[model samples]
Target chain A: MSTIPAELRFAESHEWARQEGDLIVVGISDHAQEALGDVVFVELPEVGKVFAAAGDQAGVVESVKAASDIYSPVAGEVVEVNEALADGPEALNEAPYDSWIFKVKPANAADLGKLLDAAGYKALIGE
Target chain B: MGQRTPLFDLHLALGAKLVDFGGWDMPLHYGSQVEEHHQVRRDCGIFDVSHMHVLDVSGSQAKPWLQHLLANDVGRLQQTGQALYSAMLDTHGGIVDDMIVYQTDEGYRLVVNAATGDKDLAWMNANLAGYDVRIKHRSELAMLAIQGPNARQKIGELVNQERTALIHTLRPFEGQQEGEWFIARTGYTGEDGLEIILPATEACAFFNDMVGAGISPIGLGARDTLRLEAGMNLYGQEIDEQVSPLTSNMAWTVAWMPEDRTFIGRAALEAERVRGITSKLVGLVLEERGVLRAHQVVRIAEVGEGEITSGSFSPTLSKSIALARVPMATADRAEVEIRGKWYPVRVVRPAFVRHGKALI
Candidate 1:
């Protein structure tokens, strides 16, 4: 019974994106966090690391159970990384929506529309 | 469909995430796996280990029958309720299974791993030609492992007066029977705790009572991490049908005394000892942020390639640790490959933490 916020756009891989000015803030969805169990470590991309649309290994999020790759929602260059998660990885488990992993400046702004909306994301997770 | 344990409904009610383990549907975690791990280390937690097989071997030749069945000599268990941990092996010195044998007045009771139940029972039955022992599977029973530093004090408030006195006098690696309940001072988590075997009919009530008393319901996820931190071997991982005790750091569990006495795998083990064991199990600690997982390759430069058997994030130390079987000549340093890149790891004794303290 994980919450899929109506505002946030999502990827099939379980990462969610929210538009924040020129850059979009991204984090794992509630379903992703629940499936990964308690996160013990998070490996975020460097500040300027760029990602492609379909094939990019954005970063790593590791729970006590397993480590999963967080893929990019759309092609973008990482503008900012969440440094607080390095010390307290549990933040993502506590609130997956609020604890953004990294902010990405999209390579093509239209790519955001191609991503799954709230209804589509809910359908993807079978919620 | 997988089988269900007696506590299956209770787990669902507690919001446990159930997974298929071996043929049984069991809990992976109640909610947060890390919280359960910390609870067992810092406070108290209980695990429904009823999936494990319990057998009663009775009759005239029970002692001599077990002597040949297990690698460890059970003759030393002269005192009542004394338990012995031993490995049942095949003729080729391969591990069949590992179990705990407790000597009770009626006969000897053995508790073995759940995944290896059928195979183990088949092996036992195949070797019963000369012995007068009856191997009875106690299907009507359920077991729970109540563990942690404060486990004893918490459980004391729940049981009756006689069982309370019995709990107080219970020593490590021992069991005391009272009516239908058998409480043993043994645990896989390397903590002071009890593994209780009681009638299955009363398991739900007992579980409810313990939870009502604030004992957190633990799942197999934390059970695994706790045992991994304690450096205990998992059946299919560290010591399996193909893995020998000589290389698995379980040679101590095999008794070589009374030279005349021969066990199932003794001959092959003795031959292996003479030839010298090549690969050995050791502990690996990754101080950095990466998580160590099973089957990851370990590169020891001069000693050839080895792999991590079992590994996890150690909640107590907040670092990743693992048990890797490396070359006999390997010492100190090794590198583990994760994804495509290799990272350096330090090798030490197989144990990481025990008794709620960091051993590394």
Candidate 2:
């Protein structure tokens, strides 16, 4: 079974957003990594890049099977990214929750409430 | 929904991530695809290739019927248990399917792709009016490819003493029936190994025995990478109905001897030979960080454009490589467009690794 941290919020697209004080840490869910298979390459957006909403494309993740676009979880600026992922894309596969892709400084931190909770996310994945 | 192979139960029990492959449920990986790729290169690994279609052709006119049906001459397989790699073509020179035909005592056995089974059989049935031959699709058979340097030695210890003694005497690209099993020292990976074909009922038990003997059970995820690293062609990707054998690095397989052998697609191939071959398949090596992939546009300066057919990251070489069909006038250097960005690649022969040694 995929791990769903109760404190974090999730998107239907398999991304999770954990609220940390003011900034929100965003990454793909465990279900997402297992479905993508072995990751061979990763392409992340430049720091300071701005996104209009959670739908914005922030980066790309390519597994041995196929490539998928990583979307932003909230409307914000990309304050920080997991720069270490360039050389070690397998980290995302090892632990998707621990390997946060980027931290977004949302225009309104309350937008995090729009995302689904752990129970809802689990139900969405038919857990 | 898809059909399951004989080893389906074993695969699910081993924690393999199953995927739909040509209407069949097959393992993509047990866990780590990169580690599986390394296992085959360094030691040995077993692949459940039971999804591949096997056809048995036997009759009085089997030899002559195959000579006319295939692009490669079946006349070359004179000795018993010898195998031949040939492409069955349509009248217009399009590739119907690429297959391996083995000359057995009964007649010839053809192992074809699972996706193209129906069309290939239909094509065979349509052309069998004049020739007397019985082609039976052996769906009851399951196949496994035990590949790598130590594959033979490990597999040898599993069978009976009679079969064990025969393994050392077998030659490359050759297989002989031992009771009910057909073992051939041939593989898609550029490594020393054997492809064993046996009845479906006995496959699971034998597979469990091999795995118990410490033979790593590899999945299809690594199979694609291993074949790509070895510069081998995949049926649907590299060789298709739209692509001819001339440009697909299969010219050597076609027979032009005696000037009287009337193989299907010969006239068009001869015509193409007279006109000239414009596109050629070559290997591309990317020394950079980017991974090369299929459908990616290759920018060849002045000589026009091309696209990669098979591409992946080589675990042995520690770099990305690909096989692309480029204009005959193209040179040694080109740039590939990956995710809207262009990267440089070096051109080499369509082979990278052989027997655990790096070629490029």
Candidate 3:
């Protein structure tokens, strides 16, 4: 079973959202990383990009197997992006929960509540 | 659930990630695909390839029948246990399937791809009009490939004295039968290795013994990357019924000499040669960060456009590489469009690595 931290909220597409003050930090969940095998490259969203709604295209995560699109879990504007992933994409596989892909300034903070909590996400993945 | 190999239970015990591949439930990876690829390149690794079909062809007219059936000349096999790689072409010079044929004491043995087995058999049977030949599908057998630099030394320590002697004496591209098992020095991975064909009932025990002796169990995921790095062609990706061998970097496999030998598709191939081949397969190296995938558009400046046949991140080269079909006029530079962005790539020979060494 993949790690599902209780503090994080997740989208059905497998992106995780964690609240930190006014900004929401985002990364792919452990389940997503595990399913993707070895990550070879990551195309992080540019800072200042805007996603008007939840589940919008944020970036791309490519594994050795195939490439997958990363979606934003909540409506947000990208305040900061993970530039380190450009050189060391394997960190996403080694430490997915700690490796945030981007930091988002939510357009609506209440959108986090609409996402699945730890238990709900676990159930959704059939864990 | 798809068809399972004789080593299916053993694969499960090794914590393999199972996936459906050409109607068979094969292991995609034991753990990390990249790690398994590195293992095969650096050390010894084993693979269960029993999903592939093995057929024995024997008859008084076996040699003549095979000469007509394959594009490569079986007459090239000077000695028993010698193997030859050939393409089985259709009437239009298009590839039906690529296979390895070995000269045995009785007659010959062929190993074909799993998904193309039924079609190859049908084609083979239909073409045997006046031949006194018999085709037997040895589905009761299992195949395993032990590959890498240390493969021979590792395998030599496990089997009996007679098998060990045969393993050491077997030349490259040769195979010999030891009782019920047929051991060959040919492998899909470019590494020096052995491909062993044994009875299905004895597969699990040998696989377990190999694992117990510290040989890693590799999966199809690594197998694809290994073969891609070696620049070998994949059947559905590089060559198909619609694609001719002349354009798929497989022109060498087609035997055109002995001009009167008139094999299947010979006339069409000759016509294609006279018409001047337009497109040819070449390799692409992406120095950029992102991976190159199949079906990506390849723009060759003023030459023309083409498509990537097989593309992936090569663990050996530590970069993304691909085999693309481009116009014959294409030079040493091209651009591949990945995710709407055109990334410049260097064009070279199809092979990127061989024997754990980078070629490009």
Candidate 4:
């Protein structure tokens, strides 16, 4: 079983987002980490990088088995990244909840309602 | 429906990530594929290869029968327990399946993939209509391959000395049985290890004992990477009915001697050899940041284009590498197109890394 926090919202692609006041903390879900196998390296979006909501390709993470793109959940300007991931990419595999990739300022604050909650995410995974 | 190996429950208990591989529910990785690859290269790891099919062909005329059926010679296996790797070819000389034949005192034992069981058996039966050989599929058996430099040492500690005494003298491509377990020195990974074939009911216990003995349970992801590093060819990817062994760097496995052997596809291979093979399989090491993936186009400067058959990031080399089939006239360097970017790479013989060290 995966450890899921109640406050964070999840996307169907298995990314989790938490509202930190006006900023949103984004990272991968436990299900995503388990599916990607062992993470070897991470390519995170640069600090202060602005991305559009619909087609935002924030960055990429290369796992031992395959590579996956990290999509932005909402339009935002990156403020900071989990620099610790550069040296310890497996931290995402170990703790997806706390290992947030970046912080973003949502373009539309109300867009958070579109993301899935704990129950919706669980149902999406056929749990 | 997904197929399951005898050790499927054990894999689940160990927290392996299961995936569909060739229609079988096999483990892709336990936790870390990179770590599993390193375990096999640096130390020891065990894989549940029970999904592979095991068959026994016996009778007085088994030798002559096999020589007539397979592309390789079986008479060359004069000693008991000696093994021979060969390709089962169609009448057109295209490979149907690649298999390992073990010479037992009573007859010959073969290990093939489960997917090719019906087709291979049908071919063997149709070819041996008048021969005295009998084929028996041992689907009730399970196989485990414990591979690495330290594999023998770990197994040696677990089993009784008296049981493994005969294993020490067993050479490469040879094996012997101790009680109910048949242990073979032959392995797909280019390292010292044992492939143990035992009854399916005992598979769970053996897996548990091995895991308890500190042998890490590896999945098919590392299996692919390890075999690629060892320069071994995988079925469907390297060679199949669509491709011949000659172009897949498996010419050595083909027996060309004993002109009168009259095996299947002998004449075609001979003609192919005489005509000269146009394409040859070679190894490539990526010089850039991206991972090497299959189906990528390879440009051999001034020579011709090739395609990557198998590619992955070598855990030991800390870079991407691949096996590509390029023109025989290709030079020592090539370029691989990854995501539209051509990266300069060195073309060399396979075996990019072995025994936990980089060989490039």
Name the best candidate (by TM-score): 3
> Global lDDT for candidate 3?
0.94
Candidate 4, residues A1-127, lDDT tens digits: the string is: 8757888888887888899999888999988898887777787888989987734888888786877998878787999998898778889998889899999888889877789998888888877
Q: Where is model 1 chain B poorest over a 10-residue stretch in terms of lDDT?
A: B257-266
Query: lDDT for every model?
Result: 0.91, 0.90, 0.94, 0.86
Runs in model 3 lying further than 4 Å from the true structure? none
Q: In order, what DockQ does each candidate have?
A: 0.79, 0.59, 0.94, 0.47
Better of 1 and 2 by lDDT: 1
- CA shift of B34, model 1, Å: 1.1
**Model 1 DockQ class:** medium
Roughly what TM-score does model 4 have, to 2 decimal places?
0.92
- Poorly placed runs, candidate 2 (over 4 Å): none
User: TM-scores, in order shown?
Assistant: 0.97, 0.97, 0.99, 0.92
Better of 2 and 3 by DockQ: 3
Considering only N, C-alpha and C atoms within 3 Å, which residue pairs clash in candidate 1? none
In Å, candidate 1's interface RMSD is: 0.8
The residue-by-residue lDDT of candidate 2 on B32-83, one tens digit each, is 8888999999999999999999999999999999999999998999977999
Chain B TM-score for all candidates, comma-separated:
0.99, 0.99, 0.99, 0.97
How far residue A90's Cα lies from its native spot in candidate 2, in Å, is 0.7
